[model samples]
Target: MSMLIDLEHVTKLYGNVIGLNDVSLQLSSGVYGLLGPIGSGKTTLINLIMGQLRPSIGQVRIMGSNPSWSGAYLRRIGLCPATDVYLPNISGLDWVTNQICLYGIHRREAQRLAEQALALVKMETACRNPMGTYSLGMRQRCKLAQAIAHEPDLLILDEPFNGLDPVGRIEMTQFLRGWVKQGRSLIMASHILHEIEAVECSFLLLTGGRLLASGTLSEVRSLLREIPNQVRIRSPQYRLLASRLMGLDEVADLRVERELQQLLVSTDSPAQLARTVAKCVAEENIQVTEMRSEDDTLQSLFSLLMQLHRGER
Candidate 1:
């Protein structure tokens, strides 16, 4: 099957500084989150994909065409960069209309398309006002208007949530989700894990100029099973629960939190530990007020992967 994006033995450099180091990955046609901390080459990777910067070594294929030389392939992709382009003097409509005209479209036709784009992003009314007078959320909506005016098949976003309030963030997420439902592809880059999680897409994790991992949430979560897990259990009979858990071979460590009335269990086998806990709850009548896995969260998983990458574990 043809890949949406592909990189082989890719490395990017700025003098001695490595922008992306020996990274290789393939992405299919679907929504994907480009996840990383700041200065982790997320923007660099996006630039390479967008053909703004050619890789120092290795290949970059976007929609079966190498971005390095395939200028025509650009029209197939839409990008809303992380950098804020505040054209203080220009109206939102003019800015977006000008962007569409870059694809060799006539001014009148581009203007019409730009109108639709602005309307889609709920900024058509305020589009006539100078961008400088617009709020950060309004400006971001205008930027999105420009990017989508051409109606590209692949939508790529970098930090698309930077200047939005809670309501704006929800609206932006809903809009992107609607985009995917229309059978289009998307790649959204963000440092905030929950924002990507809100979009509910597979993700590619990058750090220190390296591609650490890529997969759907469940696929990635399965990796957690290979490593030990820390599960927190709170109960009325905390001491009895702790004693019962201590005898299990899978239980690697145990800690008691007197204030919380919780037993923290570190276990290599979470499944077995769960069975034991259930047995103790039913047969011994131990009251478990709360039983939760501390490491089950996406943020914790990302932290674990970061630790593994740094050779800390």
Candidate 2:
């Protein structure tokens, strides 16, 4: 697959503070999630890719061309900014049509594209309403419509799920998923772990303006190979089962909660660990009630990576 976006030793500075430092990455045609805390250079990376801000050092390339205000690279790149700023007096329909025209489409073609974009975002019903009268979610959809008005090859969204209701978030997720199915690529920067998980995209985790990790969820999981895998086991006879399971080599640590009749087990070999637990249950005549991998969740993984990166682990 061709590389859609590339950052080579990119660095950005805001006076004395660092926005990004020696960040290097290559993205292809798929949904990519940028995961980071606030001030971790997520927004800085987005701006750099969208040609809104130039890097202080190194290079940022979108579609093999440098991203700059005058580069015209944005013609093939759609951007939905984090901010909600819009033309308050214009209707959503007019705003999107004007943007399409700016992208060099004829009046008729622009109108058709604008309406299609609004419909794609499920904002056609409120398309005629003034931007000031639209709700936050509606405005968000409008912003998305404007970005896709030209049907760019790459879509860049910053905090797209912020302030959206549950329904809106779900709708947005489905829309993004469908968008990528059409062979277009997306790079979304968001703080919400569940949102990133729902998108099921590769992740680029950043911290303190540095790239902490970048890969698929499972690939990132491999980075913390030394970190113990946490699992919760519930059995009919918890104490007896916990005692037997604790003796296995795969099981490194165990904490039995007598009140809840559950055992929180940390293990090194997740596959062997499961087999060992199964053997214990079979041999000891223990009735298993529940078993779940607790630490494999996206939030837990992010927490672990951030903690390790900060030297807090």
Task: Tell me, by lDDT, which candidate is best.
Answer: 1
lDDT of 2 by residue, 209-273 (tens): 88888889678657555456888999879988877876788888999888888999988766777
Residue 288 lDDT, candidate 1, scale 0-100: 96
lDDT of 2: 0.84
Candidate 2 matches the true fold with a TM-score of: 0.75
TM match of model 1 to true structure: 0.77
Top candidate when judged by TM-score against the true structure: 1
Instruction: Point out where model 2 deviates above 4 Å.
Output: 221-303, 306-313
Per-residue lDDT tens digits for candidate 1, residues 1-313, read: 4588899989999899999998898888889999888888999999999888899998898888888778888898899988888889999999999999999999999999999999999997899999899998898898888888899988999999999999999999999999999988999999887789888799898888988898887776576565678899999899999988886799999999999999999888787888999999999999998998887354556667888888998
